[model samples]
Target: MPDLRKEIINILDGKLLTPHFQPIVSLTHKKILGYEALIRGPSNSPLHSPFNLFTTAERFNLSTKLEFLCREITIQRYADLDIKEKLFINASPLVLLQPEFKKGETLRLLDQYGVNPRSVVIELTEHKPADNYEIMRASAKHYRGMGFEIALDDLGAGYSGLRLWAELLPEYVKIDKHFVHSLHNDPIKLNFVRSIQSMAVSLNCSVIAEGIETQEEFKAIEKIGITNAQGYYFARPTAVPVKEIDKALFAIEQDTDCKSAPFNNATTAVQIIRDITPISAKTTISDVMNLFHHNSELTILPLVDDNIASGIIFRDKFLTKLFSSRYGIDLHGKNPIKMFIENTPLCIDKNMPIDLVSKQLTSLMTNDPAFIITHNGEYMGVGTLLDLLAEFTRQQIDNAKHANPLTLLPGSVPINNQINQLLANKIPFGFGYFDLDNFKPFNDVYSYDAGDAIIKAVANTLIQYIPAESGRVGHIGGDDFIVIFTCDDWLTRCKNILKAFESTVPSHYSDKDINAGGIHTENRAGEKCFFPLISLSVGLVDPVSTSQCQSHVDIADLASEAKKMAKKIPGNSLFINQRMAAKNSGNFQSFTHSATKLHIVN
Candidate 1:
C-alpha cells in the first residue's frame, strides 16, 4: 500500500498520465458521437488501473491534484490527436468542491489546447458520497455555464446517483455495465433500461450504455433506442481511436423498427414530400411577402442555408405579425426573413417512417400545417399535415382490411409483408407460431364469450410480454398468434411469455375448476369428459438467412410445422426446431418442452 501511494505521488509529480479514448457511437446516425477520455497511470506500475490510481490519490489527500492533472492531460492529448468528435473528461464532484480546485482551470486548458469548451463534456465520476448536494449542483452548473456539458457517469453504480442526476440534470447519463451485461436475455435488465430510456426521453437527455462487450448487448441497446453507447464491443479504449464507424458493425440496408405501425416500413417521409421551392435566410421579409402573394397556394416558406433547412415561415403568422399594427410592415419590411423564421420547425430525414414523422409533427402542437423535410440533412422538400394524415389514414384502412377484428393485431397480409421485408433486408430473425392448446375443449365447457375472452387474453399477454423493438406481435385469426423476433434472445422472451400465460390464465377459471384443475365438458363424440386448463403452445424457428426460406410462404410453413411439434408436447410448451440443422439434413433436430419437462426429438 505504501509503495502504491509513493508511485501515485511520483506519477502525479511527473504528470505521467495516459489518456485512452473510447468512441461513443450514435445508433440512429451510425456515427461516432464523441469519445470519453479514460485515464491510466504508468502501464507497468501497480497504479495502472484507474481504481487503484484514483483511490491511492484520494488516500494520500492528493485527489484534487490528480483529478486536475488528469483533466489537463486528457484535454491536451485529445486536442493533439486532432479528434473531431467531442471529448468527455472525467471529473470528481468532491474535487470540484475542494478549495484548491480552480473554477476556470478546465476552460483554461481547453483554450490553451485550442479546443472548444462546448465540445468537452465534464463527466462526474463520484468516488465518494457527496454530503453537500448544493455545492455539487452549483459546481455542475458552473461547468455548464462555461459551455461544458455535464454527464453523470456510472449511474446506478454509486451512492445517490439518481439524486445527483436530479440535482445536476446532466445532458447525458451513462448506465452502469451491470445493467448492460447479458441485457438480451434478462427481461429485468431490459425493463430497467427501458425505464431509464423513458426518463431520458421525458427529460430530453441522452443515455449512454457503457461496458458493452457483445453484439447481442449492442443490439439490445440499439433496439431500446438509447442515443449513444461506448464499450469494447465497438473498440477498446486506446491512445488513438478509429475515427469512423466500421460499416460491418451495423446493417447498411437496415429497416427502421416500426412497432406501432407495421406497414410504416414501406411508407417514408419522402413519399409525401411537396417539393416546394425554398428561400434563403438572407431574403428580405418584403420579398417573402411578394413571393407568397404571387403563389396563392403557398402557406409556408421554408428557410434554407447552404441547402440545409434552417427554419420555416408560416404565411398567416408572418402576415399577422406584420399587419397587427399600422407600423408593422414599414418597421419590419426590410428585415431579413430569418427574423420571422420559427427556428424549431420539425425537420426530419426523408426516409423517416411516416408514423414517426406524424408523431414528431404533432408534438410541435403548432397550427402551421407544414414541416421541413431533409435528405441526409439537406433540404429535400416540405410536407404538410394534410398529406401525412391522408397517407396515414389510407395505410390504416388498408391495414384494417386485413387486421383481426377481435384483437386488432395484424392479420395475414401485413404479417406476410413484414416477414418478406425482413427477408428482403437479409436481416436474420426468428419466428414463433402461437396456438392455444385444448382451446376447442374450453369453448365446449365455457360459452363462446368465455372462449373469446381466453383468446383475447392470449393476445394481450403476447403484446405485454413481447417488446415491440425486439419482435412484432400479430394475431392470425382465432387462437393463433405469431411473433417475428429480431432480437438474439428470442427464446428467452418466448419462455417469459409462456410463464406469464401459465400464471395469469387461471384467473379466468371458476374456483371449482381451479380446485379440480380440469373442466367437465363434452368430447368431440358428444360424450362427457374432463378437460385440462387451456394453455399456450409456441413453436420457434430461427431462419439464419434468405437461402433457407425464399419467401413468407416457406417461413409460414416452417413456423406452422414447428407449432404442430410444440402442440404434441401437451400444455404450456415451447418447441424450437433448429432451421440451421434442417438446412443440412433436410430434417429437424427439435427441442420440445412440456409444462415441467424437456424433450429432445431427433
Candidate 2:
C-alpha cells in the first residue's frame, strides 16, 4: 500500500477540518433551537466526511488528535451563538481520555467567541468500544464541572449506549437517526423510540431526536414526546452564521401558523359515524337490543360485510319486527336477523363526518331505522344509535369540562384529579407546571384578551401534541396546565408539547413584540430588561420513590423545583430536578422510607 501516513499528517496540519452544523427545529413553532455539528474533513480531501477521516486516523493511531481538532473548530466557528442555545459537538470516549487535551484552552476559546461552556454539548459517540468506563466517567465529571454538558450520541443504535448512559449521566441524549428516520410509518420503530424517550426522561435527561426528514416523521416524533429534533427536514449541514440561522428559525415559526382550518367540505357515512361506533352485520339482535336497553340513544346499527360495510339496522324497526313475530316463537333458533336483512338499509361511505352522520341518523323517520357504511361501493360496517349516543355522551363530558367560565380549559378540579390519579396508579409521570415566562408584562402591553388568547393557544398546542390515549392534560387555572403521561413514551410526548407551545405562542403577539423576539418590559429592580419572549417552564418529576411521593402535595413540590430549573433557561421548556431521578431509582439509601416511597412513586 502507498504511504498513507504522510497524507494524514498533511490533511491535519494545514487544512481546518471541522464539523458542519445542521439545525434542529421546534416543530410546532418552527424555530431553530440549536445545531448538531457534523464532522467533515478539508474540502477536496479524500477524507471529506469525518467518518472516513476518523476511520483512517484510528487505523494510524491519530484519533485523539482529530477529535481535538474537531472540537477546536466547532467552538471557533459558532462562538457568537447565544449562550442559552446549545452547540452539539461529537466526541468519543477514547478521545476524551487524552490527558494533554486542554479543556481550559477550549473554554478560553469559547469565552473569546462569546460562547459559554455551559452551552457547549459534547456528544459521546460510540465509534469504538469504551474499555475503561472509569476514565470516561472522570472525563465527563471534569467537563461537567467546567459547565460543559454531555450527550450520549447514537443512543439505541448500539448495545453500549445504555451502559454509557448509566456510567456517564449526560444531560442530553441523541437518539440515532436510523430509529427516527421512518418512525412515523413504522409502529415498531415508533414504540422503540418512545421507550427510549421515557427512559431518558426518568434519568432526567433531555432527548434530541435525529434524522427527521418528512412531515409524518416530524409529527410522529412530536406525538411521542421528542423535544429537540435535528435532520434534513429542518436544515442541512452548512457553514452559515448565527444571524442566518436566526432568520431561518424565524421563517420556520411563520410556517407553522396555528390558524384552524376545516378538515374538508364533504358528506359521507364515515363522517356521520365519526361520532358513532360500527358493529358487524353478523351481530345478533340480542346484542343490539342489549346495547339499546343500556344506552337510550342507541338507534341505528351499521352492518359490515367483510371489511366492506353493508346497511344499518334501526332499533325501532328491529323492535317492531320482534313484537310482530308469533308469541314465544323460538327467536334464537330462527334467523331473527333475517327479517331486518330484507329491509332496504341506508348506506354511506366510510369517510363521512360525525356531525353529518348525527344529523342523518336523526333525520331518518322514527320507524325507518338502520344506516350502513360502504367504502368504494362495498359493504364495510354498520353504525347504531347507541354508538351515536355514546359519542354524544363523550362530547358532552369534554364540552362540559372545557366550558369553564375562566381560562376555558379543563378546570382546576380536573387538573388536580389527574395528578391524584397518576399518583394512585404509580405511573412514572411528569408534571409541567407551566406559567407565562413574562406574562404580566405582555398583559400590561396588550389587553387581557390578547393574553387570554395566548393562554388558550398554549392550551390548544398541549392538547394537540399529547396523544389522546397515553396522556391526560388539564388546565390548572391561570396560565398553568398540568400534563400527565405514563412511562410509555412520556419524554418525547412532553418535549414535543413544550416545543409546540414555544413555537405557537408568539403568533398572538403584535409585530413589535415579534420583532423584539419576545415581550419587552422592566423589572422590579428599576432596571430596563428584555423580558424573555413568553415560554413555558415545565417541571418534570418521575415520582418513582416513596420519599418523593409523600403525598400529592409533596409530588407537586418536587415538580415545582423542576419547573423552576426549566424557567432558568431562556425559552419556553421543561426541566427535571436531578435528584428526582436518583431518588426514584433507589440509588440513595439515606431515605428511611425508601421501599414505601418506591411503591408510592411507582
Candidate 3:
C-alpha cells in the first residue's frame, strides 16, 4: 500500500545503505591485495543487496540517482585506505553513461574523499543492455585516463561478457566461481580455467577466481593457474574491515596439499619387444648382416629350432666369420638355418628384474651377448636398457603435444584433429569463433605480454562455456579460438561461453581502463581518440545445408565473415551465418563488397 519506491529513495538519499568489504587475496603470497566493497540496504530492509536495490530503482526510473548515491558513499567511507591496495566499487553500464557521471565530477568526488582514481577499480556489471557500448566505452576511456581502473565483473556468466572484454580490456579478470567450483571433478573445466589463466598472462592482466569455497575447489583452481581467489570458504562479505586473514592464508598454503596426492597416485606401464635373429640360423652371411642392420643394438642374435632355444651369434664374431669365408657371396642362397647350432641360447621374461638379468647375462660371458625374452618358448616381447630409455623419450613427446606452450592447454593440433575427426563422421555440430575486439590497441598501449594474457583469458572463457559432451576447443593462434558442440544444445553452449568471457575479462586491466570501459589510443592522424569498445563477435555456423554442400574451409570462411560482421555492430553481438538455402547460378553478392564471381564446387 505504501509507496515502497519513494521510501527506498528517501532511505538511499539519507545514505542509509551500509557498505561491506570483502577481501581479494593474492594466491601467490597469501596476502590481501585489496577489499571489494559490497553495498547492503538498511538492516531488515526489503532491498538487502545493491543488485536488488538497483533493479527495483530502474523499474521506478531512479537508477541514476541511486548509483550516484551509492558510489559517493562507498568512496567516502573507504577513503583512508592505503593507495597501493585496491578498492572495488560496482557500477552498471546505465549509471556509467549518465550525463551527470562525467569524468570531472567523478574525479572531484574522489578528491573530496582523499581517494585517488588509480586505487579505485570500478567493477562493470552486466545488469543493463550493451546497446550503447560505444558511448560507455568512451566514458570508460576518459575515466581511465584520470587514473581509475576498470574490471569486467561476473565473467563467465553473461551473454555479452566476451564482447565487453574485447571492447574494454580490463586489467584484471575475475573468474566466475561456477567454473572454478567443479574444476577438480571436470577435466574440461580445469583446462578451461588454465586457458583463461594463460590469456590473462598474455594480456599482462591479473586473474582472481571467484566463489572458491571448498578446499577441493581452491586446490583445483590453484593447481591449474589461478593466483587470486574470493568466496565463502576464504571469507564472506563482511561489514567490518578485516585486519588479518590468517584462515584464508592458511587455506591457500594447504591448497597444494590436496592437489599433489591425486597427481602422485597416477601410474602407467610401458610395453617392450625382444630381438630373436641369429647368423648361424641363416643359410647366408648376408642374412646375419641384414639382421644387424635392422637393429643396430642387436649385439647377439639367438637361434631357435623345434620350439627350443638354439645357438647365439655375436655381431663381432659373425662379421669375422663372414669376411674370412671365401664363399660369402655364394652363401647368400645358402640355408644358415641348418648351419646354426641347436639348443644353444637362453631366453627370459620381459618383466624379469633387470638386476637379475644383468647378473645372469654377465655370468654367461658369451661375448657379453644381449639376452632375449620369450613366453611359452615363443617370442612375446623385449626389454633392454636402451628400450627403456627410448620409451621414456617417447612419453616426453606425447606429453608435450597435449601441453599448450602458452597456456599449457593441449595444443591446437590436438584440438583441431579431434574436431575434424568429429566433423568427418557427419555428426551434427555447432562451431563458434571467438575473437577479442579492439585488442590491437590494448596490446600497443599495454605491451604484447599483456595482450598474450588477454588471449589466454579468452581461451579459458571459451573452455569454461563448453558443455561436458561438447567437442574440443581449438586455439587458432593469437586471439582467435574455435569451440565445437555436437549435442542438441549447441546455442546454449555458445551463449554461455560468450557470457563467461565478458565477465572475467575485466580483471586484466587497471581500475582506470576498466572504469573507462575501453582502451585509449591514437588514430591514423596521430590525434588522441577512443576506438569502439572491444567485444567478442561470435559467428555460429551450424551443420544444416552446410553438412551436404559446405566444406570445412567454406564453413570456416563463412563463420569468420559473420564474426567480422558482428564486430562491426556496436557493442556485443552474435550472428549465425548459414549458407544460402538456394545456390545462385550467377554472380553472388559479397557481404562486404560488391557482387563478385561465384565458384561452384563440382
Question: Which candidate ranks first by lDDT, i.e. highest?
Answer: 1
Candidate 3 lDDT over residue span 1-602, tens digit each? 55768768777778788778888876544567788888888776778777677678888877777777777777877875443578988776666656665546667888898886788887776744556577558756865887878887878886676677767888777877778877889988887887787677556566788888887887666555466788876788887767556744434422332222111111111144554443234445566677677988877666554333434566676665556653353564354533433222445544343333444446444333344465434444334556644655674576467666676555545555444444454555666676777888888888999888888887777666663345556676677777666566776666565566666667777788888877779866788878644566676666563465334566677678768766665554566666543343332222111123222211
TM-score of 2: 0.43
How does each model score on TM-score?
0.57, 0.43, 0.42
Let me know the TM-score candidate 1 reaches against the reference structure. 0.57
Candidate 3 lDDT at 110 equals 86
Best by TM-score: 1
lDDT of 3 at 459: 71
Better of 1 and 2 by TM-score: 1
CA RMSD of each candidate after superposition: 10.2, 28.1, 32.8
lDDT of 1 by residue, 129-196 (tens): 65667766876888898998999999889878878887788989999999999999999999999888
Ranking by TM-score, best first? 1, 2, 3
Task: Write out the backbone clash pairs for model 1.
Answer: none
lDDT of candidate 2 over 1-602, digit per residue (tens)? 54567667887787557657787654322356667887777776777776678788888888878777777777877764443557877766566556656557667777777786777877766655655577668768877877888888888776677888887889888889889877767879978987887777557677788887877787667546566788776678877623223333322311221000011111224533434566766676676677878988877666554444434566776677666654122465234443354323544446554444565456544334345555544555565566656665665576566555655666555455545554554444555566668887877677799888888787777777774445556676677777665435665666666666656765777778788787656776766777767776676665453235745577677767767666666565556554655844543211011112211111
List the lowest-lDDT window of 10 residues for candidate 1: 252-261
Q: Give the C-alpha miss distance for residue 86 in model 1, angstroms.
A: 17
